[model samples]
Target: MIPSLDWLLEQADRKLKKEMDPDVIAITRAVITELAAEGLPVGVAQAFRTKQEQDALYAIGRTRPGKIVTYAKGGASNHNFGVAVDVFVYADGGKRAEFLAPPDPRLKQIVAAMKRYHMQWGGDWGSFPDYPHFQLYDAVNGQPKPLLGPRYPGRPLFAGAERMDRTLIRLIQKRLRLPLTGQFDWKLTQFIEQFQRQHRLAADGVVGPVTWRHLFGFQR
Candidate 1:
């Protein structure tokens, strides 16, 4: 049988409860409780990270030391926003809990449990397979949008020139050196398409994740 949440936390060294978003912390607690009920007592390995810490982690195996553990740098990761968490399944009376890759049974169970809480599993990512990671997601267009706050929509800002009259239009105009008309008309769409082509992104004229990342000087 599994132990109580307090007991489980006592068995671990890190209590990242204070470092996570309130909703994310609640969801994580629920997941942990449910996992324990099912005889799979998992331990929290990581939670929030400051931008400086994230930058340090990003430097691993590239500049500083250690192996490559993460792809995001500084402000690019959900961990920096207290929306992501990593977990590990403990064994031998909570004495040992190692990070396991895919094809591991415990990882599979954790993934399923996280999904029940409407969380996105990092193991499901196509480019980076992180079996021990999970985060809050807002469903949009059949895709899981990470909770990136209001300032960062975490999804498409504007697509297909639909919202043609907004402040973003003025920003785009200023960015492209066009007349500051504050209109997302066909001219702006054509300019964005050209920019997308130059940047090797899909020329859909929609300010999606890739486009926004590039426009805001984020690493792809």
Candidate 2:
């Protein structure tokens, strides 16, 4: 059976309706349905991102010490406002996945889907090509949709409490080279605390702005 879209939406964001614009969601759903019908079952890898998350991705290979993953800064990316999503084409009965890189044979299909839904594919960009990204069109140059606003403000999202955001926890695990359990378990908490201590931030297990800065802003 195919994965439930509702569950996928929840995985993308806990407060999806609250975090994402209704128009984006509608267009994305239509695109997904068309893709599924065309036998290209795509799954949403990312949808909404906080400013800190975007900054962290942008910091890679720049201010931070890793391969550059993005060109957009915190407020620059469409993802920071929940109008964008990253998708992966599933293979092997959804066990394996394929990232839609440039010149890939599958890109034509994805781009077509994006067009049908009035979304823009990042792969078409001349500079800093993003293969797996798509976003709703902004109301410019004859585009039909207006750009959405940010959902997560540029502030500490967590303090004095444990975070239940599976996506953020998974990102932290990937950054720390830990197993991607997608769970903020005791082990992950310990790791976060240690990371915080080493970074000269508060050793609280809570993942606040300070921790996010160190986690995604720069390398150790």
Candidate 3:
């Protein structure tokens, strides 16, 4: 029941074919396979849910899915671009459920397993709450960041939409605070809006609920 080796290859962005040495891919696959060894590795699910998934699941403003999952749709989501993935839970009786819709207890098990594999849990992605997603991260010392350097030195994002200059934005935010807004000499509204786009925040400049909360806890 292990995932097909080819499926893992699709999970990576095309640029990965250029950047990732064969050894790197093998190492990553080994990691994921090893984590699922205890359970039946039932093959890889769609790495990232797209706008189509949202459309299918939502009849009204409310999500038809059992759990609150995913905030990003299409280009906005890390998944649509292939940076994240969802895993299913397998127990006895040969039952497997979508990780995104799995019960809470199962979600915890997946998270623990993901942590063991050194993947970042999407549940860590702020209050929006995503229990079944994981993304890879690389870091040295105590700082965690995208494995590829700025502009993805070797690996690049899939197709369109700028990769979002995370390092620069993070640097500016860290070096400067609310006062940094003054550095731009732009209206507060515009500043917040830009910040949001750069950091993958919802682009609403009001900073009403989620935006302000992330800013507060965000380091510097």
Candidate 4:
């Protein structure tokens, strides 16, 4: 009874004028078309569940149905925000009007489509693994400028190492006058690790920012 966000909400903006993120919507339509081609008529699900439906469900002894359905934070779902979609599998011909499987062959085709478009399939989640779900994952730190203020207060994440490596390696080579030797290939890595230890950072040799500073600024 969730008053889902149907296509109607997408057509003409009544007040909010805001549209769904284009990438998410495009990926969704592609999956739907591909699923149809594979022979299941899947349509979008109700995204924004109506208040009436919420009240009715509340009356029916359910305060939050997502606690029963989802593994992720309940209201803070991709579906609720319209970046995710759910598809059902209904057969073309049947003795009675019915849908046989959630991962009907048709549904599998949708999964394939999502992957081709670089979208993540919900079925990949080990904890939840919703086969009928497809979602555009939120970008982490791929932006030109990293977002300010830590998302986690103290979680110990070490992302962006690849790009960070190129920069740190350059700084280290310039500072200590190491044999750049035209290629870091191996020797430079060993030098960087020793440099990291002398600087009091972990000697992982991964050339993080702190390691870069010690190699260049602190003259270690």
> 44-131 in candidate 1: lDDT tens per residue?
8888888999999999999988899988888778887777888887777676777878788877888876775567888888997888
Local accuracy by lDDT, each model: 0.71, 0.67, 0.46, 0.47
Candidate 1, superposed: residue stretches over 4 Å from native: 1-4, 10-14, 138-220
TM-score winner: 1
Model 2 misplaced stretches (Cα beyond 4 Å) = 1-17, 138-220
Judging by lDDT against the true structure, name the best candidate.
Answer: 1
Q: Per-residue lDDT tens digits of candidate 4, residues 109-191? A: 66666665555677787775777666565432232321221112111113333223343344456665775433454566677
2 or 3, greater by TM-score? 2
Which model is ahead, 3 or 4, in terms of lDDT? 4
The TM-score of predicted model 1 comes to 0.58
Cα lDDT over the full model 2: 0.67
Error of 3 at 80 (Å): 1.3
Cα lDDT tens digits for candidate 3, 1-220? 5444344344433323433333333324544454455553423454545567655544334546465444444445544444455555434433454554435664665666555435677678667666665665422123343333222123321112256344434433543354432222235457667777887877765444334334432111
- If scored against the real structure, what TM-score would every candidate get? 0.58, 0.56, 0.40, 0.42
Clashing pairs in 1: none
Q: How does model 3 fare in lDDT?
A: 0.46
